[model samples]
Target: MLFVGGITLLKNFERLMEAFARVHERQAIPLVVVGFNRWRFENDLAFAKSHRASAHILFPSFVADEAMPQVYRMASCLFFPSIYEGFGIPVPEAFATGCPVVTTNRGCTSEVAGGAAHLVDPFDVEDMAQGLELVLSDQAYCQELIARGRARPPTSASTAAPVNPWIYSSKYFTKLPNRRGPRASLAAPWGISREPLRQCQTYQGTNYMLPPGGVMVDSPDRGRYI
Candidate 1:
């Protein structure tokens, strides 16, 4: 199994570790946790040790972007049960790399999964353990998820164009700072200039925004662009 996120409260790493311990009790599965934050590393490590799961969990700390695909391909499934996210990039990344996903039933994760993943309640440890077991034991179901994931990206990409103008407008208005503000130093790196940015029709009740030149896409409250 694999998990990708920093050791942050919002990422819900502790709950995942507890759930993994339950799964490990039944089967000696090695879980690769592929990100870390300094603030929580010691506490997370202590929790793992307390659960007797330290030996089974690997904290890789950081993995290079170019090597992420290989990491995803090696895992049986990607576990991403974040409490909240602006958008969940790892879901689609796992999808594109043909890794089955077991993510949260709520928030942007369920939307990104597009019914192609094994959804579990993030707060329910038993449910999460069951999700992990099902994905690991059911070969047919795993393949089905893989097939659906492979089919998801293209359809999502084709529908993302309508949101580009929204992205441009939102980023210009919200992310860019005035010429003399404290964040003025960020302008050059982000390619911001004095030129007037175009405004696009706002898609009401949506939180979608695409970075300049980013290719990943999604729908309103149902998909994401990364």
Candidate 2:
């Protein structure tokens, strides 16, 4: 039995149902959709009625995490072509369970898969078909990935950098302001640019001189140039 699991969005659920219909034509594989919504299946009544193998489509609302290993063992591959994601966790989990993964190459999915899974453009149906084909038809490639996946060690946490809790705390996370506005003027004393002015005064009644440190600091308090 082939298993499809994820948040049951209407569009994705419909595609999964249709794809199963098409694939069942070539091979009589039963599809058990775990975590799918019953409302979605009911709403697509007409489409479901016209499906080639409606009986083969099983909708199980929720499956526990502990049972997922058994689910992966029961399937040939996991077909997950989500439209978008920030960081896909399911791909890694599927790979770790010794299941071949075929998913979209959107967002950080490519980085996560790391050539361990078959990738395809989410928007291209042909690409999705090709991805499915590569996994299904190419036995040697599929076996190679399964081996790599089994041997692949778990990844390290991205937020493992050493942070100074005393210097910067969680409170600073919410208080950051957007820097799109004009930059504030520097608060240091203005230095003489053209020539070194030990003590020179301009019409504005300010002094421009090279400081002891030879560093120039722009200042708004002193008006005249010296």
Q: What tens-digit string does per-residue lDDT give for candidate 2 at 99-146?
A: 888877776667777778888776666667666767777899889878
Q: Please, what are the lDDT tens digits per residue for candidate 1 over residues 1-226? A: 9988777777888889888889989988899988856577778767766766888888774687768889999998999988887567678778878999999988888887889999999899999999999999899999999999987753322123232222112222343333332211111112221111111113332233344443323333343223
Model 1 stretches astray by more than 4 angstroms: 154-226
Least lDDT summed over 10 consecutive residues: which range in candidate 2? 157-166
Report lDDT per candidate: 0.70, 0.57
Best by TM-score: 1
TM-score for every candidate vs. truth? Answer: 0.68, 0.58
Error of 1 at 22 (Å): 1.0
* Model 1 poorest 10 in a row by lDDT: 183-192
